[model samples]
Structures are given as C-alpha cells and as structure tokens.
Target: MNTLLLIEDDHRLANMVSEYLQQSGFTVQHAANGLDGLKVLQSTAPALVLLDLMLPDIDGLEVCKRIRALPGALAQTPVLMLTAKGDPMDRIVGLELGADDYLPKPFEPRELLARIRAVLRRHAPGEATEATHQTLKFGSLELDRDARSVSVRGDVCDLTAYQFDLLWVLAERAGRVLSRDQIMEAVRGRELEAFDRSIDVHMGRIRAAIEEDAKAPKRILTVRGVGYVFAKQQD
Candidate 1:
C-alpha cells in the first residue's frame, strides 16, 4: 500500500480524510502542524504528501520550501497543497515554487480522490517490465539514462530532475501518443490523483529549452482531447 503523509491542523478534517483515504487503499499518517509534519517526513518518506496551507507552526508554503531544501528527502516527492485560498495568484505562486497541485477547501471527496490518484500516477516509478526502454531519442534530442540528463543537438540542457524525467519518457517513445495517465505512470512511477498540469507545464519548460520557437513548437505536439506526443520529426 502507498503511504501518504498528511499535514493538517483540523482534527476533524484530518480524521475524516485519513479514514476516507485509508478506505481507498492508502496508509495515511497525520500531523497537526508543519513542524511535526516535517519531522514525520524526515523519518518516513511517504509516496506523496498532502499539505494543508494553514498549519499552526509554519505556513504550508514555507514547509514546502524547506522540504525542497532537505538533503535527499522530498527532493522529488510530489506535494499537493490544500488550502482555502483560491486566488489565481496563490495557485500560480504555489506551482512556481514546485507545489504539484492546489486543492481549495470545500472540495468534493471525489475530486480530491481524483487529484490524489493523478499525483501518485505522475510520481510513481516506471514499471520493471521487459518492454520498458532504457534510453530514448528523438531527432537531436537524447535522454541519457545513465546520466539522467537531456541533450539537444548534442548540447546539454540544464533540466530539473522532474523536467528530465518528463522529457525522457516522452522522447523514449517518440511519435507514440500517450495519455496524461500513461505518461504519468511512465515518469512518476506511481499514481497521481490531481495535479496533471505539472506534466504540461514541465513539458513546456522542456520545449523552451530545446525548441527554436516555443510559441509555435514543432517537436512536442499537443493532440486535441488526447495527451502529448514528441514528434520524431519537425513540422
């Protein structure tokens, strides 16, 4: 079972969420404050983190920053911010700072569950199936498995860990259309419940790094109603 670390101050809310998620097949651990949540995360690395923005000791944004700074812990863990702050600016800031998804309070249980599954799907590791590719290439783009680096036209592009992983998955199966869920499974190695935009945004960043014209991308093509595909050849 996938372990989840939840940081929320409201006991009633925590209990409710813990019970519901447990019933949905996750092992949930609850912390009432940011500090306590951080401690628990340090000791036990959960598959995903559900963080409430209104923590008592520290704000959830600060907690997220601190976690990103931690040595080797949560560096790649997907964080979903749960808050009542529904402003557009708040969501943008959270995403910019690496929060995978934001769920406002008063959300439906079904929506929350979907978001959780999306996040987990994005972060879960790739399967150890015999069909998985060890390396993938497209035109001048290359994803080096041993180095975990992305190279375009033989020049290395500075990519974040998540960015590289996303590109690597897309490039490895060039021309193949992959749904958001399929891409998430290949890249994240788990399941994601809600933050599917992370994949799109990260793909945009990767294209900006490689494409000659990001505004009119030629290599990474978006299929309407479908997911995304890395074009084997430029249009």
Candidate 2:
C-alpha cells in the first residue's frame, strides 16, 4: 500500500478524506498543522503528500519550499496541493514551489482520487522498461529514462515529478509544436480544462530548472498563440 501524508487543518474534512483514501488502498497519515506535517514528513517515508495551503502555524507554500530543499530522495517526493483559495495565482505559485498537482476545495472524492493516481503514475519507477535504459542528450542537457533524471551540463536539474514528465514529453517530441490541449492530453491522459494554466506554470518551472536563461529560453520555446516546442537543435 502506498503511504500518503495529508496535512489539513479541518478535522471533519481530514477525517472524510482520510477515510476515502484509506478505502482506496492508501495508508493515510494526517497532520493538523504545518509544523506537525513537517515533523511527520521528516519521520515517515510517504509515497505522496497531500498538502493543504492554509495551515495554522505555517503556510503550506513554506512547507512545500522546505520539502523541495530536503536532501536526496526526500526532496523529489511528489506533492499534491489542496487549497480552498480559487485564485489562479495560488495554484501557479504552488506548482512553482514544486507541487506535482493541485486540487481546489469542495472537490469530488473521485476527482481527487484520479489526481492522486495521475501524480503517482508520473512518479512511478521503471519508466524505461521498454526503452532499455536509454538516455537522451541535447547539448549539455541529459535525460536518463531509466533513472528518470535530468541534468544540465553535469549538474542535476531540480524538477518536480510532473515538471520532469512534461519536459520529457516535449523533448521526446522535439521540434513539434504541441498545443496546450495536446500537451495536457499527452501528459495527464486528460483533456485540458477551459481556463486552467497549470501546464504553463509547470513549463515555466521546468525551464527555470534546465534553461541557462529562463527569460529567453532556447531549449523550450514558446510559440505564442499556439503552444510550445522543444528545439531540435542542441547547439
């Protein structure tokens, strides 16, 4: 069973979510505040974290930043942010801070379950099972499918699981301009929401991690009205 840490302040909501997730075959751990959540995170090894944005002690964004700053494997752990705030900025900021996915409050349990599964699938191991440990190289950038790691020059690029997957999809189809809908379908196996900008947020994060200059990225180029394309030329 996959262990999941749920950091939520509302007791009733926490109980409901935990019961639902537990029924869905996850080992759920609950924390009522950011400090407790951080402590639990340090002590337990969860497959994923369901972080609530509004915590009594410290905000979830700070917890996310701290989580990403952790050393080794702990740092790369997938996070799915939960928020009551419907602001696009909050969702963008959460994704920018290393959240693999985000779900707003008053969400259906089924939708939440789907998001969890999608995020977990993105983080699953044996990604190169059919590729035979292949590594793609573009200039100084290196992507190892087996290890699911990306490195620019000789240094590792810090990316969340979702960001890495998004980059991989674009790089694998280098030179092709993928519309947001197409990209979302390819990456998430779902249609793009009418006004959702999560993909753009994730792309920005990916560029920041791998590009020498994110402001004028050469690797992942924006196509303005259409979408984005990963440059085929390395040099």
Candidate 3:
C-alpha cells in the first residue's frame, strides 16, 4: 500500500480527506501542524506527502525545505501541496520549494485523488527505466541522473526540482522539438492553463543557468508557433 502523510490543521477537512484516501486504498497518516507533520515524515517515511500551506506551527514551506534537507531515503520523496491560496505565485513558490504538485482549496475530492495518482505515476519505481539513468552530455553541459544534478563545463549549477526535470526532458530529447503543452505536462505532471506562463518562466530560468549568455542563447532555441528545442550540440 502507498502511504501518504497528510498535514493540515483543519481537523474536519483532515478527517474527511484521510477517510476518503483510506477508502481509496492509500495508507493515510494525518498531522494537525507542520512540526508534527515533519516528525511523522521522519519517523514513518511515507511514500508521499500531502501538505497544507497554513498550519498551527511552522508553515508548510518550511516543512518542505526541512524535508528536502533530510538525509537518507526521505530526501527525494515527492510532496503534493494543498493550499487555500490559488494564486499562480503561490503555486510557483510551492514548486520552487520542492512540491511535486499543488491542489487549491475547495478542490473536489475526485480531483485530489487524481492528482495523488498522477504524482505516484510520475515518480513510481520502474517508470524512468524506459531510459537508462546514465548521465547525458551535450558539449560542456552534462545532466547527471544518478546525482539528480546538472553541470555546465564541470561547474555544478543550482536548479529547482521542476527546473531540473524540465531540462532533463528537453536534453534527453535533444534535436526534437516539443510543444509548450507537451513540455508542461511532461515536466509539471499536469496540463497547462490557457494563460499560464509557468513553463515559459521555467524555460527562461533554465536558459539563464545553462546557456553561455541567456540573452543570446543558441541552445534551447525557440521555434515560433511550435515551442523550444534543446538545440543539438555541435562537435
């Protein structure tokens, strides 16, 4: 059974969600505050976490940061945020803080369940085995799957987990162009909103990190009306 630690201060909602998830065959553990949630996570080592941004003690973002810093098998566990805040900025911040996905408050139970399943689908064991986890190189740029890290000319660069996933998707498909929607779904594990520019925003940051000069980028080339391509490396 997939164990999920759900952290939410709203007792009624927590109970409802916990019961619903349990019915869906998930082993659900509930926490009423961020600190307790973190403690549960450390002790129980759940498969995933469902975190609410508002909590009685410490905010969910802090909990996420602490989890990201945790040593051993817990560090890479995916977190799916549940927040009353529906703003795009809030969602982006959650993603930056290592959240795998976010479901706004007033969410339908069905939608929440779907998001949980999607998260599991994306990170489940044997999923990425479709391609070997070996490092891939394009000129001076190297993507190290084993390290879950990237480097440009031997210098490791910082990237948000989302950013790293996006770069990896494009790099692995080097020379093949991917549409914005396709890229968004592959990287974010969700479809993009009509007005959402989150993918573009992430792409810009990625170019800044890897391109010699983000302003005059030759790689990550833009193809108007289509999308961006991880421009093929030249010998």
Candidate 4:
C-alpha cells in the first residue's frame, strides 16, 4: 500500500480524507500543522504529501520549500498542494514552490484521488513508456532517466519530480518547440485552466535549475506568443 501524508489542520476534514484514501487502498498519515507534518514526513517517508496552504505553523509554501531542501530522495517526494477554492494565486505560488500538482479546496474526493494518482504516475521510476536509453546528453548537460537526475558539468541540478518530468519531455524532443498544451499532455494530461500559468511557472523553475542564465536562457528558449523549445545544442 502506498503511504500518504496529509497536513491539514482541520481534524474533521482530515478524518474524512484519510478514511476515503484508506478505502481507496492507501495508508494515510495525518498531521495537523507544518512542523508536525515535517516530523511525520521524516518518520513515515510517504509516497506523496497532501499539503494544505493554510497551516497553524508555517504555511504550506514554506513547508514545500523545506521539503525540497531535504537531503537525497526525500527532497523529490511528490507534493500535491491544497489551496482555497478560487484562489488562483495560491495555487500558482504552490506550483512555483515545487508542488507536483494542486487541488483547490472543497474538491470532490474523486478528483482528489485522480490528481494523486496522476502525480504518482508521473514520478514513478522507469515506466515502460520511458525511452530505451537511460541517459541523454546535451553538451555538458546530462539527464539520467534511471536516476531521475539532471546535471550540468557533473553538478547536480535541483528540480522537483514534476519539473524533472517536464524537463525530460523537452530534452527527449530537443530542437522542437512545443506548445503549452502539448507539453502538458505529454507530462500530466491535465486540462489547462483559462489563463492558467502553471506550466510557465514550472518552466521558470526548470530554467532556474538548469540554465546558465535563466533571464537569458540558452538551453530552453521561449517562443514568445507560442510556447518553448529546448535548444538542440548546449554547452
């Protein structure tokens, strides 16, 4: 059973969510606040985290940052953020903070379950659809599919599980400019919200990690009104 950690201060909601997830064949660990959630994370090592933006201690954004700072594989643990319904800013910020996905509050249990499964699938190692070759090289930059790691000149680049998948999609199709919808379809297969900028945010994070100069990126180039393309050659 895949264990999951839920960090929500509301006991009633947490109980309901935990019960629902338990019925869905998941082991649920509930934490009421950010600090407790971090502690539970270290002890439980859940497959994913369901983080609530509003916490009694540090907000979910801070917790997300802290999680990304953790050592080793733990730092790449999938994060599914929960934000207030209709609060697009919080959801965008959550994604910018390295969340794999976000489900706005007061969401249907089924949708939550679907989102969780989707994020987990994207982070799963060595899926059959993965390229036969385990690694790809672009000049000094390297992407190791088996390790789910990216490095430039032997220096590891920090990226969230989602960002890694996003980068993988672009790197695998180097020299091709892909629209936002195409990229999303290849990665998570989620419907883009009207005026949604989540993909752009993830791309910004990816560029920050891999590009020598994010503001004047040479590896990943924006097509202005179109989308983005990973440069075929890099140094």
Candidate 5:
C-alpha cells in the first residue's frame, strides 16, 4: 500500500481523512504542524504529501517551498494541497509552489481519494512496455519518461512531477494544438477539475525550466483563444 504524509492541523478532520484513506488501502502518517511534517518527511519518504494551506506555525506554501529545496529526488516528491479558502489564488499559488494538485477544504472523501490516486499515478513511471519510447528529444531538450527527468542541452531542468507530465503530454503530440481540456484529459487520463486556467501557470513554469527564454518560448506556444502546441522543430 502507498503511504501518504498528511500535514493538517484539525484533529477531527485529520482522523476522519486518515480513516477514510486507510479504508481505501493507503497508509497515512499525520503531522499537526509544518515543522513536524518536515521532521516526519526527513525520517520517512511517503509516496506523496497532503498539505493544508493554513497551519498553526508555518503555512503550507512555505512548507511546499522547503520541500522543493530538499536534496536530490526528495525535492520532487508530489504534493496535493488542501485549501480552506475558496479563492482561486490560493490554488494558483500552491500550483506555483510545485503542488501536483489541490482540492478545496469542503471536499468529498471520494473526490479526495480519486485526486490522490491521480496524483500518484502521475508521479509513478509508466508501464514497462512504454520504456521503448521513454526518452523524447526536441533538439537541446530531452525528457526521460522512465527517469521522470528533463534536461536541456545536457543540463538538467528543475520541474515538479506534474509539470513534467504536462510537458511530456505536449511534446508527445508535438505540432498539434491541444485545448486546455484536451491537455488535462491526456495528462490525467481521468476526469479532473474543469478547464482550469491555472494550466497557464504550469505552462509558464515548464517554459521557465526548459526554455532558454520564457519570454520568447519556442517549444510550447499558445494559439490564442485556443490552447497550446509543442513545436516540432527546435534549436
């Protein structure tokens, strides 16, 4: 069973979520605060982190930032944020901080479970048979599906697991203009939150990593009023 580290302060909510997830076949380690969560992370590597945006001590956004600063592969650990606020900005900020996904506080247990599964699937490597087409190239940019790594001109690029998947989806269908709905559909392989504009934020993050100049992105271009397309030719 996959393990999940939940950094939430509400005792009642925590216990309920823990019980719900446990019933779904996941092992959950709960931390009441951000520091404790970091401590737990240091001792154990969970498949993913379920972070609450508001905490008694340090906020979840700060925790997410620190997680990304961790050494090596640990920094790439998938994060699914829980936001009590209905503000779209909170979700956008979490996404900017490398969160794989986010669900508003009043979320149904079933939706939460589905979201967790989807995030985990994105972080995990594809099936063994897909290894034949594992590495994708676009001039200087290279993506290794098996390694879940991206590099530009042999130099590695820093990207969240979710961002990498988004880029990979576009790259695999290079030259095709994909609507935001289509892109998310292809990436998740399941129904998700409707065509959220936050996808633009993720695209910006991906370009900042792999593109020499995010201002003049060449690899991924927006078609205006439509969606984005990964360029076939690159230099």
Candidate 6:
C-alpha cells in the first residue's frame, strides 16, 4: 500500500479525505499545518504528498519549494496539490513549483483518487523493465527511461517525475509540433480542459531544466497559437 501525507488545515475536510483515501488502499497521514507537514514528510517519507494550497502556517507553495530543496530521492517525490482557487495562474504556479498535478477544490472524491493514482504511477519504479536497456538522446541531453533520469551535457537535470515524462514524450517525437490536446492525451491519458494551462506551465518547467536558455529555448520551440515542437537538430 502507498503511504500519503495530506497537509490540510480543515479538520472536517481532512478527515473526510483521509477516510476516503484509506478506503482506496492508501495509508494516509495528516498534518494541519505546513510545519507539521514538513516534519511528517521527513520522518515518514510518504510515496506522495497531497498538499493543500491554503495552510494555516506557511503556504503550500513554500512547502513545495522546501520539498524540492531536499536531498536525494526525497526532492523528486511526487506532489499533488489541492486548492480552492480555480485560477489558472495558481495552477500554473503550483506546477512551476514542481507539483506533479493539481486538483481544484469542489472536486469529487473519485477524481481525487484518480489524480492520486496517476501521479503515483508516474513515480512508480519497476514499471520500466521493458525499456530498461534503452536511452534517448537529443544532442547533449540524455534521458534514461528505465532509470527515469535526465541529464544535459553530462550534468543531471533535477526534474520532477511528471516533468521527465513530459520531456520524454516530446523528445521521443522530436521535430513534431504537438498540440496541447495531443500532448496531454499522450502523457496524462486525458484531454485538455477548456482554458487549462497546466501543460504550458509544465513545458516551461521542462525547458527551464533542460534548455540552454529558457528565454530563447533552442530545444523546445513554441509555435505560437498552435503548440510546441522539439527541434530535431540539436547541434
């Protein structure tokens, strides 16, 4: 069973979510504030964190930044953020902060469970045996699918699990312009919602990690009003 640390300040909501996730086969741990959440995360090292954006103490974004600053595997742990704010900017900020996925509040329990499972699957090891011996290369950037690792110019790029998958999907089809819908479907097994900018946010994050100059990216090019393409010629 996967363990989950839920950082939420609302007692009633936390209990409800905890019970629901527990029934879904997760060992759920709860923290009412960001400080306690960080402590629980370090001590328990849960498989995934369900972070609420509005914590009584430090905000969720700060917590996420701290998590990403941790050493080793802990830094790359998947995060699924929950927020009552449905603003696209908030969602984008959360994704930019290294959240694997984001779920706006007023969500169904089933949707939350689905998001949790999807995030976990992206981070799960031992599922890449089929591609164990294969590595994809684009210029100096190397992606080991089996190892779930990426490096540019022999230097490792710190990418969250979801970011790596997004990069893989793009690199695998280098030079092809992929619409937001197509990319989302291929990577997340889902369609893009109207006005959803999560994919754009993730793409920005990916470029920041792998591109030589994020402002004038040469690896991933924006087609403006269409989507994006990974340049075929990296030289």
User: Residue 132 in model 5: shift from native, Å?
Assistant: 2.0
Q: Best to worst by lDDT, what's the order?
A: 5, 4, 2, 6, 3, 1
Candidate 1 versus the native: TM-score? 0.66
Candidate-wise lDDT, in order: 0.76, 0.87, 0.80, 0.88, 0.89, 0.86
**Residue-wise C-alpha lDDT for candidate 1, range 65-111, written one tens digit per residue:** 88777776366677888978456555555655667677888777777
Lowest summed lDDT window (length 10), candidate 3: 187-196
**lDDT (C-alpha) at residue 177 in model 1:** 96
Considering TM-score, which of the candidate structures 2 and 4 is the better prediction for this target? 2
lDDT of 3 by residue, 1-235 (tens): 4999999999999999999999999999989998889899998999899999888889888888888888976887889888775576777777766777788888889889888887776665442454676788888899877566789889977565556778888988999999987777676446534335667766777788888899888779888999989988653
Clashes of 3: 0
Cα TM-score per model: 0.66, 0.95, 0.79, 0.92, 0.95, 0.94
Return the lDDT, model 5, position 181.
Answer: 89
Q: Write the per-residue lDDT of candidate 6 for residues 1-235, one digit (tens) a residue.
A: 4999999999999999999999989999999999999999999999999999988889999999999998877888789999876476777888898898899898899989988888887788655666457688878989998888999889998888878888888889998998877777777634425345777888889899988899989998999998989887765
RMSD of each: 5.3, 1.6, 3.6, 2.3, 1.6, 1.8
Task: Give the runs in model 2 whose Cα sits over 4 Å from its true position.
Answer: 127-131, 189-195
* Clashing residue pair totals per candidate (backbone < 3 A): 23, 0, 0, 0, 0, 0
Model 5 misplaced stretches (Cα beyond 4 Å): 127-133
The lDDT leader among the candidates is: 5
Give the per-residue lDDT of model 2 (tens digit) for 134-225.
Answer: 77899899998778889987898888877877888899999999988777777763442534678888889999998889999999999999
Cα displacement (angstroms), candidate 4, residue 22, comes to 0.9
What are the clashing pairs of model 6? none
Model 5 C-alpha lDDT per residue in residues 1-235, reported as the tens digit of each score: 3989999999999999999999999999999999999989878889999999999999999999999999977788889999985678888888888898888989999999999998888888766565375888989899999788899989998888788989999999999999998998888744766667888989998988988899999999999999999999968
